[model samples]
Target: MADLTMARLHEAMTVLYAISLVFYFIDYLNKDAKAHRIAFWLVSIVWVMQSVFLGLYITETHRFPILSLFEGIYFYAWLLVTISILLHCLYRVDLPVFFLNVIGFIFISIHTFAPNQIAQSPVGDSLISELLIIHITFAILSYVAFSLSFVFSTLYLILYNVLKKKKWTKQWTRLPSLDQAQKGMSSALLTGIPFLLISLILGLQWGFASFDHFSIFDAKIIGSFISLLIYCLILFGYRKGKLHTTMYAWTQVYAFLIIIINFFLGSRLSSFHFWN
Candidate 1:
């Protein structure tokens, strides 16, 4: 019964976030401070409710709530919202906050509606030690950051084309400037790469310690190295001015696709590292 109530609360939180997203969109389009203020308060309320839900789960389980795919998604969405709130409070970045929350709402909605995904049992701490848990957590966070970078990069490409054609839209106006978008993309990559590297190192250590027949040639392992190399190349190309802006952005998009494939397909096909 308590679990059901928590699930309902999470659903309600998603609904509230959706409502807040609409208000933020309106504020973005119409420059309405009142609407923006309302959206801010709505987000805060949802965050508070989510915190309580997470706290209850942690209190009951004596563990973090990110031991399952569903819980990881929920926690990722929570992190996005937390960042959104911080950006709003610190920088007053209204449109970015709106965009971030849009993504957050999508993630939370998936968690709310996907019963099969949520029904999967969480991996216990007994099965996976603390180092493995940390590795997985950081890896997931790095992927989330990379995902956001991809979004920003996509926006940058779209706006670049719009500018080249000398066409402007209201939506274009609401988006960050091309330079800002590029910076955002770069910043996310910079933040994610270190986490990804650390996670890889820790994951390797955990795998070797936990498995009797761990191999570096596993599908997931190879995919991780590929992803890391591709991102590094993209960053290098960007820094060296070897890749054009649009090209760099497109590279990020493709790299993100590879990440998606590796995460969903490669992980499943791997002989080891199949956490899902």
Candidate 2:
């Protein structure tokens, strides 16, 4: 029961942390004071929650939580969150604080979703189920990020066409500026790529651990990997001055279609994933 409660608390803290990152990203883009304030408070809450957990661990284990790999990851993530909050409060460095939390989020996700380390569970079999849960959760979050980027990209194209045609409708007045849309689309992609990469890694690890006849060339696995690579390529191209304006928007649209297909068709084609 205690473990279960801790698990739920860990999950809740991660969700809060992710939301705070979103706000921080907004503040990073536009320097919105309200957004910055909200982010700071949310991060503060997460830090407090982490501190409570650490306290509980110390009380129960009678030692600091840096003695094992699992405990070490939790401590590391906690330290990052602590430092990130301090940076936000002391220096008001938006970009550095945002990135610090992102790294912290990744490590926290790993620690939260990691398999039980109890002596009762065999070491090899421990990863079979919990890692799958982590893989699916991370993958879904990545899709959510991608979906948001798709909306921003779509808006960019709409605004671009409207401007090209010179149809200055009041309805179009509320749309974000072209630069804003572009930045938002890029930010979403940046947030998503690391998540998808982590999901792929955890998924592959789960596959190897869970299956007797696992193939690295499995259809779903390949499709997901390809999706990650394409997004990386798109981001790389944009950063290199190769894609922008209509071209950049169109690229994201096409890449999103690949994700859609990979999600539905790839699942059906995979021999084990369908059953799993």
Candidate 3:
């Protein structure tokens, strides 16, 4: 019975995300204020509902679902959606909603379609529940924030590059000025920094305590650190006034690519912080 309800909620969440994504695209393309507002509202409601569902899930299982990659992906998507909501509200920028919707749709869609690949029911053991939540809460939050920022970075890069080459002026110009896009990406980075720090700190603590300090030196950790450095460097550029919106945007896109490679870094490489 609980399984059925959880499955239904997941389905509902996916559909809601898809609907929100469609409306956001419409808002982006048509520049319709009504559609934009509707899209934003939908994202906000759906995100809050997702949090409620997660709470229900943990209550039912009495455990955190941070044991597997698919579960991690689900949690990551949740964090991204939440941060996307918070960041968009803070910035009040159109482009953030547009790209975040698109990226959220992709993340949700892949997981929805590959259900068998992602879901795993770990034993609800007592020993790990508290520690599990502690680990997963930070784990998903940080990586997911980085993941969303990567998407924003990608958009900034593409938009900036297109403008530089003068490729799609009339269409792209309607999207957002490069300056607005740049600001939006920077905003995402700025907001994401703290989450990443928390994640990294908790992860290190867990590693040192468990395995008798036998931490796995994996690719994800190295890649994530590299990603952290890349963004930091970009931020430094901003501080020095050398990272123009467009250039900063370009770095974000590259940063996203680097992050994607890091996904496999967790699975394949040996230095990943959370190589599960």
Top candidate on lDDT is 1
Q: What RMSD does each model have against the real structure? A: 2.2, 9.5, 3.8
**Candidate 2 error regions (>4 Å):** 1-128
Better of 1 and 3 by TM-score: 1
Per-candidate TM-score against the hidden true structure: 0.90, 0.55, 0.75
lDDT of 1 at 101: 88
Q: Alpha-carbon error at 205 in model 3, in Å?
A: 2.5
TM-score winner between candidates 2 and 3: 3
Error (Å) of candidate 1 at residue 207 is 0.7
| Candidate with maximal TM-score | 1
Summing lDDT over every window of 10 consecutive residues in candidate 3, give the lowest-scoring window. 120-129
Query: lDDT of candidate 3 vs native?
Result: 0.66
- Please write out the lDDT profile of model 3 over residues 73-134, one tens digit for every residue: 66667767776787678866566556666666677666666758345433233235355457
Which candidate, 1 or 2, has the higher lDDT? 1
- Once fitted onto the true fold, the runs of candidate 3 whose alpha carbons sit more than 4 angstroms away are 63-67, 87-91, 115-117, 121-135, 151-177, 191-194, 237-245, 268-275
Error of 3 at 261 (Å): 2.4
lDDT of 1 by residue, 80-199 (tens): 889889988987656677777887898889888986754465356455578877988898888878877887887888889999998886656767788888998899989888888998
Look at candidate 3 and give me any clashing residue pairs.
153-252, 153-253, 217-270, 217-271, 218-270, 218-271, 218-272, 219-271, 219-272, 221-272
